[model samples]
Target: MTLPSLLKRALADLWNDLGTHMLTTVVIFLSALIFSFFSLIYFNLQNFVEHFGTELGLVIYLNKATPQDRIPALYQKLAGLEGVQAVVYISPDAAFKRLASYLKDEKDVLKGVDPKFLPPSFELRINRAVFHLDRLKRLAEKINRWPEVTKVQYGQEWLNKLKRFSVLLRAVVLISGLLLVLSSAFVVSNTIKLTVYAREQEMEILRLVGATNGFIQGPFLIEAFFQGLLGSGLALAFLYAGYRYVETLMGASCLLKGVNISFLPWTFIGIILFGSIFLCVSGTALAMRRFLRL
Candidate 1:
């Protein structure tokens, strides 16, 4: 049969059974929505982790009595260290100014502060490739032993917690994603089976008239394709609306002041659409196979 003929027949079938098709579409939509929601969470978490990684570094505070002349040598030594990408020296005045900027809203708190009381420091940007906890700990320990250094701070506890949380999040996403796929396919397959059963008599008539399996299944597959496309598209639209609403609601909240929430990327959007269509078609094919014994 021609593609146009198949589409026409599919449309006719859909119009004749609008109620059933609507229900099936709703099922697909809900399934896609749930899956997409979790995927969005994982995507954001991954982005946050990467951003944190890029910003991760060490701050080496100098002793108050450390010689001012030793700073240049200390900067070069840190720059030459393995896994150190760059070393920036922060003078006492610069550090003091930064602290003041942070506390600008509470200016009275710094009224009696002196820049001389603030220690100078070196901020070391570490190479991402070697940004492991153990490696960072080793580096911090070695730097802490320096006579000119007062302390080395790298937020080791926070990084360790983040690493553990990231691993757990990945595992949960993987397991739940598999479960969602299987459950969605099962539900869709069963729904499509009912659709096939409803038209069993017509299929029998076609078979008796010597119709090929492909010819008999073409319209049904096309119908499934339309359902999948409509359902997935609507699901994405609804999800985006909800995402935007939440984002707007949180935009002014102090808790999320510096955080950025983004929508799914084009690659993920394409995957969800393609996966929805594939699932629907595969489900219909499975139902047709069982009914036709083909």
Candidate 2:
């Protein structure tokens, strides 16, 4: 048979067993949707963390009596340090002013407090190229030895926790995605196997009439491809609706601020679709292998 004839036969067979085809497609759709959903979350979280990492750094507080003349020198030295991106100098007066603004409504509370209570400091941002835990620890120790410095504090515990959490999230996404794909493939394979069994006599007749294995198998593969394509399209549509619903539910209070929690990008969407088709085709191919001897 020609290519067009084979495709027509495939469509007819798929439609003839509409209930089973629909069931298999639904299973594939749900699996693909879940995989894409978690994948998007994982990528979005990675992006958020990378951007948030800029806020992770050391705050070097200088002594209260540190002279103004020496402040510029210390700032220059800190800025020139390896792995340091930029050093922001906050004078005691400026710190005090910021505190006053925070308690602006309670002006009486600041009546006796002196600006000297707030010490000058340099906010040190690390360069992304060398933003490692060991580097940060060594830099903090070096800064603590500065004669003009009073103390150094970096959010080591929280940064480590965030890194660990990101790793855990990725592992969870990977394992869950694998399980979903396997489960869906099992269902699709069994469904296709049943369909093949139902038409066993017809396939046997074709084989006896000089039909090559590929010729007999072509329609089944084509049918599986259509099932996968339809399933992926449905999954994407459902995901889009879910995305909109979530966006609406989040309202204006999403703590992510500038981050977009929308659907995955086009490239990821293509991957998800292609992965679904590949899984379905593979399941069909496996099922056909044992029956091809007929």
TM-score of each: 0.82, 0.84
Write one digit per residue (lDDT tens) for candidate 1, span 49-155.
65675486899999988888988899888999999998989999998888889888885787777877899999999888776667888999999999999899987
lDDT of 2 by residue, 128-238 (tens): 766776678788998899888888988877767777887898998899998998898888889988887888888888889999898889998998888888898888888
Residue 145 miss distance in model 2 (angstroms): 4.9
Candidate 1 least-lDDT 10 residues = 45-54
Candidate 2 Cα outliers beyond 4 Å, as residue runs? 81-85, 125-147, 248-251, 254-259, 265-267
Q: What is the lDDT of residue 10 in candidate 2?
A: 91
Task: Check candidate 2 and list the clashing pairs.
Answer: none
TM-score: model 1 vs. ground truth: 0.82
lDDT of 1 at 13: 92
Q: What's the lDDT for residue 174 in model 1?
A: 74
